[model samples]
Target: MTVGFVGAGRIGEPMVERLLAAGHQVHVYARRADVLERLVAAGAKPVDEVRELATCDVVVSCLYSDAQVLEVLPAIVAELDGLLISHTTGRPGTLQRLGHAAIVEAPFSGTADAVRAGRLTVYLAGEPEQVATARWIISSYAGPVVATGGRGTAMRVKLINNLLLAAITQATLRGLAAGRAMGIDESVLLEALAVSSGGSTAARQMDARGGSENYLAAITPFLRKDLVACRDAAAEVGVDLSDLLAAAYDGPMNLGV
Candidate 1:
């Protein structure tokens, strides 16, 4: 398949490399010349303009934020004759601004390392045919392509996923702190939880990163971005997220709630 891609950053660049290695003809674009050159060196064709993606079989935008997606994606869909798959995790309304192109809203879960390991999980939302076509292209890097009905639903699911993860992370951090107060080692507390019923991916991640401090430092920026997006999205729909948001903000991580 001939694929057009944008936003070759930490999360996106790995997907481009996987697509190229899967033998797809990938035309990549980035605002930065350095990013363009890096993707080009990874066997992707560099495109100067986003509109040049119109001629490809599929166009995928994995930009950093909803702001960037809003700024960049309308150009490709304006002339695009093929499916457009968005992997950015943000507001559902963000996708609505891209016009009536055949679009699959696929906000994925998992990290850049997950992409490199072919273990990324994608929440898919679109018309059936568009989603069916998107699964093939997305499978090059993603493990599971979970369908979530019509457009916008995938982002909603992703926001909930991030919000819940944040809550779990906060709860785990608080529990570990309590354990410390009780004279238990924080690291040992994490290790015990990894095998206990209280175990969570968030707790395991803290253990993986060596401790709470390093884990908090590493994920703070991305977690803050996702949590704020979740809060904003919930507010737009008039959904009360106070209970969840309170737990998320109650931790020591300082995610800028």
Candidate 2:
């Protein structure tokens, strides 16, 4: 299959590499010349513009946010002949607003490490035939291509997933800080938590990173963005997220330990 890729950042670059490895003819475009050049060196054809990708069988966008996706949608919709698989973790109504039936909502979970290791899980929402049409391309670099019925469902799931991620990580950091103040060694506290009912993926990640400080610093901005998006989504549906927002926001800001 001829696949066009937009945004060759960390996650996008590895996906393009995997597509090339799977024998797909991959065409790529990115504002970063260095990023695009790296993929071009690995067998992807570099396009001068996003619309140049219109000739491909599928166009996969791994951009950062809804704004970036919207910025490129006009050119893609006007010129593309095949499916548009968006991996952006944006608002629920974004897929419908794209106004293209061929567009599939395919927000994913996992980090760039998972992408390179082929362990990323994709949440797919579209018509059955549309999901099937893009499954092979998405599955080339992702695991467990989960179908969630119709458009917007996948983004809803992604937002919920991110909310839990933020909540759990913040809770883990607080637990570690409290334990340390009570005179327990950080490593011992983490090990005990690992086997206790309090164990979580977020705790394990913090342990793996040696401590919470650096990990928290590195992820705070990105996690804050997702949390804000979740808050907005919750507001649209009349759901109150005051407590969740307080925990997720205040903990990071007050991290003096």
Candidate 3:
């Protein structure tokens, strides 16, 4: 398939690389020349403008935020007749608001490393035909393609997943802090947590970072972005998340002992 790619940031780059490796003709566009350099060298064509990608069979967006996606959507919508698979983790109603029939929500889970390793899980939601149209492109980089049904369903699932992720990470950090205050070695505490019911991907990440502070420093900004999106989505549906919001904001600072 001929694919157009936008936003070659950390995660985006790997996805594009995977598509290229899978024998797709990927045309990429980004403001940063440095981000595009490696991909261009690896046989992907570099387009100077977003509209140049109109000829592609599919255009995949992995932008950092909804704002960026919205900003780029007008240009993409004006030119492309093919499918738009958004990998941005944004609010539930975003893809619908774009007002394009060809657009589909395909929020993904996993880090850049996971993408390169082809271990990323994809949550897909759209009309049956649209979902079917995007499956080939999405499957190129992601592991299992989970169809959640309807445009916003996948985004809601991704947001909820991130909300639980934030809670788990915060809880793990607090547990480590409490263990340290009681004179338990951090490694030993992590080992016990690993063997106990408290074990989680977040706990494993904290162990990899050697503590809470480093992990928080590395991921807080991204986590905060997702948490804010989740809170807004919750508010739209009359759900209150005050306690979760407070804990998520406070945990990184106070719980990183």
Candidate 4:
């Protein structure tokens, strides 16, 4: 299959590599010329414009935000008769506004390392047929592509997952702080939590980064992005997330406001 890809940035770059490695003919486009150089060098054809991607069998969008998708993808998607797999994590309202027939919201959860290792989790939501068609392309890089029902449903799931991660990550931090106040060694507490009932993915991730400070610093920017997106999404639905947001923002790691 000939695949077209956009926003080939940090996370997207590895995915493009995985696709090309899987023997798909890949067409690449990025606002940054340097971003495409490595991809082109790895055998992807460089597409000069987003609209040009409309001709490919399938196009994957790895854009960073709802604003970028709204600004860059709609016109190109409007021209597409094939499927558009959107990996951008954004609000469902964006999809409703565009109302395209071919888009499959496939917001993902994982780092670039996870993508390179084929361990990324991609959530798929769109027309059933469109989603069924997306599995092959997505499987080149992501392991479990969860089919989440309708077009906007995946975004909601992604946002909800982000919120849970934020809350849990900060809760881990708060727990460590409480341990320290009681004169317990952080490592000892973390090691115990690793095998204890109170342990979580966030705690494991923190351990992987060597400690809380390093892990928080590394993921702060992404946490900021997801939290803001979650806030906006909740506000749109008239749902109050103050308690959740407060728990999320209660620590140093929860950088999103």
Query: Residue by residue across 12-76, what tens digits does model 3's lDDT show?
Result: 99898999999999999978888788888998999988978878889999888888878887788
Worst 10 residues of 2 by lDDT: 248-257
Each model's TM-score?
0.92, 0.91, 0.92, 0.91
Residue-wise lDDT of candidate 1 within 1-257, one digit each (tens)?
Answer: 89999888888989999999899999988887777888888889988788898889999888878888888888888889899999988777878887866989989888888999999999999999999999989898998789999997898898888888888988898899899999999989999988889989888888988988888887777778888888888898899999998888787778876
RMSD of each: 1.8, 2.6, 2.5, 2.0
Which is the leading candidate under lDDT? 1
- Which stretches of model 2 miss by more than 4 angstroms? 191-196, 253-257
lDDT, ranked from best to worst: 1, 4, 3, 2
Clashing pairs in 3: none
Better of 2 and 3 by TM-score: 3
**Using alpha carbons, what is the TM-score of model 3?**
0.92
Top TM-score: which candidate number? Answer: 1
